[model samples]
Target chain A: MSEQEFTIEALKQILLESAGADENIDLDGDILDTDFEALGYESLALLETGGRIEREYGISLDDDIFTDHRTPRALVAAVNACIKDTVTA
Target chain B: MSARTVITGIGVATPNGLGVDGFWAATRVGKNAIGRVTHFDPTPYPSQLAGEISDFVAEDLLPSRLLPQTDRMTRLALVAADCAFKDAGIQPGDIPEFDMGVVTASTAGGFEFGQNELKKLWSQGSEYVSAYQSFAWFYAVNSGQISIRNGMRGPSGVVVSDHAGGLDAIAQARRQIRKGSKLIFSGGFDATDLHLGLGRSDRRGRLSTSSDPDRAYLPFDAAADGYVPGEGGALITLEDEQTARERGAQNIYGEIAGYGSTFDPKPGTGREPGLRRAIEVALADAGVEADQVDVVFADAAGTPQLDREEADASSAVFGPSGVPVTAPKTMTGRLYSGAAPVYVVSAVLAIREGLIPPTTNVELSPEYAIDLVTGQPRPAPVRTALVLARSYGGFNSAVVVRAAD
Candidate 1:
């Protein structure tokens, strides 16, 4: 089976499922550059999302991913990089 | 004089009903909510009946985000807190954040959540467990979740004295109010069914094993067995009386006049149980004479030995049948840490309406001289009510609630 690629759409789904979207913020809009905090996702929410990603994708993620990937764009890219490393290695 | 602590709002989630109005209505009419445990299969257990809030769907009442992080108990507590805040007609932002606090009680913490996580750990490995389990399984999570949700940052805590913890937590909130906090959300809730199995094996020997709901938990009855376990409780919005009046609080339920707690001496010591002392101290603290107490809300453990002890204590303190005693918990079962606060709610409501709710399904044995109010709701001038609770490990607590002037 082919591996699923980590994308902004995937991250959006995970964010919504893990933390739920803020009523005031539109998750479908250009939220790639929006900070998770601005999107109403806090550290605990990010931790849950990261845990879900690791379990689903068979990859381990560092806790600092929450701090380093503050936006959906950065988190998607970081997750895709980890997936690629797992596939190649 | 010290500032008086009064309950301004009440939110309830009980087996018989939800919210203050629904619960009080069912309680006053002596409705029984105990039935076969449907939360899970009870066919294998000896004790099949419990007071379950079968219709409560947390997802329907709470935000989706909270659904992922909280256990059923915490969800119930959060919802109760929301109802209390709304009932009080005061928003968290209306008061200074630092002026509000949360003090709650928990006996089992979030056992169902912890049990689920443990199952995941054993079957799918520890990595499969949800990170939310970290806080969800904690006893203090109810207080923490309520605090975070309402921005109550002044002082927060969870009392864990089992059944007595409910009144203990409210008393702690009273202390915070005395210390100048304007608003405090206090009370407790429990949704743990882990002990049902123990009750089956007679390990605790404190659960009713009858299949028939009507005869299952007959406290003070000649055929009394033991208590049917239950879930749900209440969150009371307690405010400094002066502050509540100044803020134009629409309803002031009653003043939490006095509190006293004591631990039972070792069983083999032959020392008297501390329940009587607790009641006396509470009356002294409230400066109320024993004869002045209009009604007594009993712990009603439902076991013969414990029932006799409670009856003896009440008779000794109030003189034989001197005060009208009731245990509306007969309708809801013993809710562990949640029991006392609900009784407190009943007391406050009784004070307001001057109608004492009845102890349903219980036939007081003539051997006990206490005047147990049963069969029908008693109409009387209830100006002051005393609530009593005793925990499994011999913790006893008493609180005196009086009508606000």
Candidate 2:
């Protein structure tokens, strides 16, 4: 699949895996609208997840991505943009 | 009646093992966990061997959020606390939040973390240093994080009283429980890997420079020279007797009968009477006599002078016959502030199993008329145990633990 095809579901899975099985996170509904703190994630978790996404997508992201784009959908879009930039370059 | 404090759960990240069962099995057979240092290059230092928790991967054990905020020492402490909580069958929200507390100890907190952050500031820029670096290196970080993570909002504190701080932390835990806190997670862990602190502090010529793991830390032996530094920690669940019984906690390890601390008036100022006094006070506070102590977990400082002082102190307490002494730390190098808690865990296990784990890599010195248990595990009715620890700067602490009556 192309970098543009990266789905919000994929990002949701990453967030769930990062949070661990014990955490009470809802994956099916409005994951993009959910606050990371609501999912038992803190700033460090967001930073770590950002790092993992960067590695997985073969791209680099700004340190402020978590602050600027605070949801899974927004993070996925940012990740996609980075991946597309890498591919085009 | 005083609020009786008991160890209901034990969690340890030692060089020997991870949890209570693994630690007990390793200690039972006198397994050696010290090896050549792998965390950092040891060529520049005098000591080559260290009892490091090489297998631990903090990311795998802890929550993702804790990864950035924790140093290796804090990770070890949190993991041990996790194990202790699990072993006690208690979860974060299981009990009343205000009734639970934490009391931990550390000598060198996050030495490696602070060192790395300083390196970033030196080479890159001040902006490159992570924000978490500020609190991550503090000695009280473990207690604070453990409390925050577990929702334990009761009276929480940290002890910074050298290596004996581990025992002192436990002593403080008992006091907290008596003063109203129903449960407390108390122990100690230390890491000296990156040399921001401990490496420079060993200038007193006390650390062992031996390259061989087997001969590196032969405490109480005639050939004893110095001790190998180690890294790790152990935390135990200290609960009120009524609280534990109410929760149906079946595995009661032992009770903290009494604890005492003394200070040697700065080395050479006087005969090191602090250790002797600490032991005596602990026994008296426990309402126990020296004869009632089934086993003695000795400090076993390994240095010729310190070992002699400890031996003299033990002899002074136990008299001519002498109590059976063992230093299981031969299996894992002295973990600085963490040393005493693991020894406390060992004592509790010894009391439960009715056996004294042998002190490995030692030949009993003829000069010291102490029955140092060596070679193999000794079967004994260990109804009570006396554990001892002393810090570098004249501080000494002792605790008397008794099997549940």
Off by over 4 Å in 2: A1-89
Give the Cα error of residue A23 in candidate 1, in Å: 2.9
Alpha carbon deviation, residue A58, candidate 2 (Å): 20
The pairs that clash in candidate 2 are: none
User: Per-residue lDDT tens digits of candidate 2, residues B1-405?
Assistant: 686899998889888888899889999889999898887677787767888877888878886656766788998888888889889988879879999999999998788888888898899766456667768889899999899888999989999987899999999999999998878999999987445443765676778888889988988788888888888879999999888988899678889999989988765566556899999999989999888998999888898778888888988889844789999999998888898999999998998889999999888878887898999999999989999999888889999999976
Candidate 2 docking classification: incorrect
Once fitted onto the true fold, the runs of candidate 1 whose alpha carbons sit more than 4 angstroms away are B194-202
Q: Tell me how many clashing residue pairs each candidate has.
A: 0, 0
